[model samples]
Target: MTETTPAQLIARSNRLGADPKNTNYAGGNTSAKGTEIDPVTGTPVELLWVKGSGGDLGTLQESGLAVLRLDRMRALVDVYPGLEREDEMVAAFDYCLHGKGGAAPSIDTAMHGLVDAAHVDHLHPDSGIAIATAVDGEALTSRIFGDKVVWVPWRRPGFQLGLDIAQIKAANPQAVGCILGGHGITAWGETSEESEANSLWIIDTAQAYIDEHGVDEPFGAVRPGYEPLPVDARLERAAALAPTIRGIASTDSPMVGHFTDSEEVLEFLASEKAPALAALGTSCPDHFLRTKVKPLILDLPATASVEEQIARLHELHAEYRADYQAYYEAHATAESPAIRGADPLIVLIPGVGMFSYGANKQTARVAGEFYVNAINVMRGAEALSSYQPISDAEKFRIEYWALEEAKLQRMPKPKSHQGRIAFVTGAASGIGKAIATRLAAEGACVIVADLDLEKAAAAAAELGGPDVAVGVAANVADAAAVQQALNDAVLSFGGVDLVVNNAGLSLSKPLLETTEQDWDLQHDVMAKGSFLVSKAAAKVLIEQRLGGDIVYISSKNSVFAGPNNIAYSATKADQAHQVRLLAVELGEHGIRVNGINPDGVVRGSGIFASGWGANRAATYGVKEEDLGQFYANRTILKREVVPENVADAVYVLTGPELSRTTGLHIPVDSGVAAAFLR
Candidate 1:
């Protein structure tokens, strides 16, 4: 099987499911039914606005979309399962279409129903197809993925496919992600953006594999997951897991595989399952857990028994689990240390080789990478001999040991930013980027700190000046690096200005199963990181005798009445108050502090789309067209601000614009005062 993309996603209301006469699935837009106020933003989820029916996502637009409510679609599916009253479903859809005239629901909505992620994207990239269909795909996948990724035997895709992924994650908590044999890959995250990156990586990996083989064939195949099945029954069942992730590929092509290669260093690259992942990654990092940090190739003899293989693998896992227990027992001294619920450190499933654990998804990914590197040596040991990443026992114990969990707890506290030159983490993109860019454009020399130094440099470069921007890579949460970034900024830019504490991340997860470490990440960046960057900035600002501004990028979430927003909102509230206190204390020397509240800024480098988790995106109506006006409509000014807009606002505070005002906040949203303000 090869990778694929849907030529068109026709709304059932549109009556344009197929065009036998024309290959393109073309249809008209039909209005959706039902509209309601989004609790978070109060913006109406316009139930009607189907853009178009049939068009490849690569070429999709608002015109290609058909709008329909998740509720209404559920109604239709309710009537149509058992292939019962499909016509009735169609008739009902038609009535809604004629009444609304915007867009119809996609036929594949049921598939999306199965996912727990937010945004879903399915495409048949050429490279992905090649690897999926290759005869020795298992070997090739092993060669490419190593221990970084998990390989699932080829299975027909659909509701079962989504179930497989969900099950895999649960069964193998140590696995980074799973690979679909003979089918394109899938990735998920706490946010829509991270999922998108994971999706892209699937294709990236395929392309890398093809390139390695140096072959190009007419890559085409039947679309795997899109057959019209009895979807209505499934929809009802899937909806139980509120906010389904959905994606449809109209055609199957080889260019759809994920990942390029493990070009990233293990320790440096974060884990796939790590928290705030939606903020950290562009796409899936080189998949390591199931795939190995890299791949392994073995021309096995027919004499090898399945039992023999199972033993070799389970034995390794036993070693891992045992070591993990030992480590936890040793480190469990903290009257039950905070990270008691942490995940396993390492896992080795026989033929699956081995994988390492990480503090966060990012760090776990780093662990996978170590094993991937080790795999290369395994192959070189001899034909029958293979290398494992530090035996199962060693990895398990290391990964699970309480000392490991303690390390995360004992991470260097954030720098006390009292004017010592505040550094904003995540400045490569989003709110942080906006603040940094704003500072540089406004004449204050700004250093863009990001984990990806290249992205940092590019962001600065976009300012179109050398002196205005200095790209410095550092994890703001890391004390030493935070200090180092500050030192570099001081040496190069002279001194720090009002540190615009404007970098933040959010993960929309139901608290029930959300990992323990993820919650820490939210505080680490929003609360802890804020304290560190501001503390450093305070030192420099206080010494200068010049009052400074520290603007934080908080969210409407802080004031929300909801369930999943706990980690983010709580941290935002804490951060906002912290700024207030910092202002009161630092005001003695002219140092000022403030925070900026903005709704989602979807435009201008939408990394969220890059890492989109198909499930959540659809729930919040994070469609492209809706994004432009989504926040705009919610704000008071009826203007949707972007990263640049927020950046400019922060720059103003640091520049001549707001020299007098401190201990205040500017709402970047046009009219969204009620959410965070009132």
Candidate 2:
């Protein structure tokens, strides 16, 4: 048989990890044993390559594997201080490093190393977990796979658990794997192909059994009046309540949110047993780690007014916080890590759907997905028998595990705009796009709102796909369009925390040459449009009760008395004052309003490229090509300003550095004396 290599192991891991039915995001571990010449001794030595801590299987890379000397790894069993000191074994793995180990070893490293197989897979597939969590799991395992698979009783994953599995494998010579009681499954094979095939067989067989013998309605009958709201109404309600839920979830720390009203979620929410099941919480450690101990479920029916639902949400959130604090107190010991946060990570609304929160968008979205997996597990478990998760004490042990705490502590500090959602008008190109890109780089989820839907979508994709950005079309001058844009933002990222008013068209003309159409067009999009967008965003921001930012990308023309720029100048001036007015009016609600005045952003400016560049050049007696330089020469700083320059000013004004400064304008025209705020 050809020996499995690291590359092949990665391929196998990706195949299994990519499928949700096999395992969840960042939830499983895979390993391969091989022999390589030792760098120091120039002799062949066996090594175990296992997925590292916090690495996801689907995207696993060679660098994400922890390589340990097989001899040293197995030798630790002799010195193992028993289950009481199992955690210390994780640190001891460092001593077993084959070389400069690729990545930090995960706690499950022992499980893979101690198992006497060329390949091993420990997975948390929903189907496998369903049977593992069933009250009659041991009996069911015997009935389903017979002698081919065995069952291991509940035990915290550590060195002892590894020894037990190794012993089980040795004793049951014909057994290919075992169902981990109250956990998941572990499978092994002499080769990588066999390992992957065995894992799949177990998962597929378990699912087949559940499907054939399971009850018709695992979640119970749909409750009256608790049916899903109409599609539009459901979204509208989710948008209305998302901000408040996000705010409540952010009590301990700022968080980004994700909303899901998928068919499965709706069905579960409408089920008679949903309340009881949700309260019992998720069974898998991976599920609860991301979702929290359990979700905070809104008891109100779909018929309840959004206002009533929101009120109930607050009460439920308070109760969840209190209950979480009690859970921590009940199980915490002197050595346990301090309670991380009392705020619930997942919130379930009977009619609307689910809202999951995390420090960022991907995490938030994945948490929601994991909860769905939990839902699946419950459905299958209930159908097979009774769903029984590990005890609270066991869950508490894992949640506050020292190793897990270290992992959290190792996370990088958040970027300045982390957990913020920004809606940027005209974001398909030029200055707006630059601002959106900059904000996204600083960890903000961006809503790229533009008049052109295709261009907006392309730009959003370029920024980082749906997780970091989404595109929405809006004619900001229209109140309905503006409101819809804000609604899209709320649905996309829970709420809008920052608003950038930058969509405008320029038609440079003398006061006599400027027609009524030009004046109205410029004013409607820039002046009134800013007002419409701000008004709509304010509702969400106020509902969230989270202080936010509103920035106007007013031009230097707002202040500079440039010639033949009457209509454009008027709208800029309007936008400038609107910033000040809204700053004062919205300050009570903690919304900061600011403005940026930029000149000669001609190179990449959509306004300039669209005829304004040539028109401005003719007015100044310079070639259109030299227009940017001409504007720069006239400025105090002689350096031509670009869209990125304006973007930098936007970041500074709205970032933590200017947290205390508002109702201000920061000039970004390379020190334009005329544009300076006096």
Top model number, TM-score: 2
- Model 2, residue 331: distance off in Å is 1.1
The C-alpha lDDT values of all candidates are 0.46, 0.92
**Model 2 per-residue lDDT tens digits across residues 118-221:** 89999999999999999999999999999999999999888888999999999999999999988899999988999999999999999999999999999999
Model 1 regions lying over 4 Å from their true place: 1-424, 464-466, 605-607, 610-616, 621-625, 676-678
Model 2 poorest ten-residue lDDT run: 1-10
lDDT of 1 by residue, 218-249 (tens): 21121222121233422222221100000000
Local distance difference test, candidate 2: 0.92
What's the lDDT of the predicted structure labeled candidate 1?
Answer: 0.46
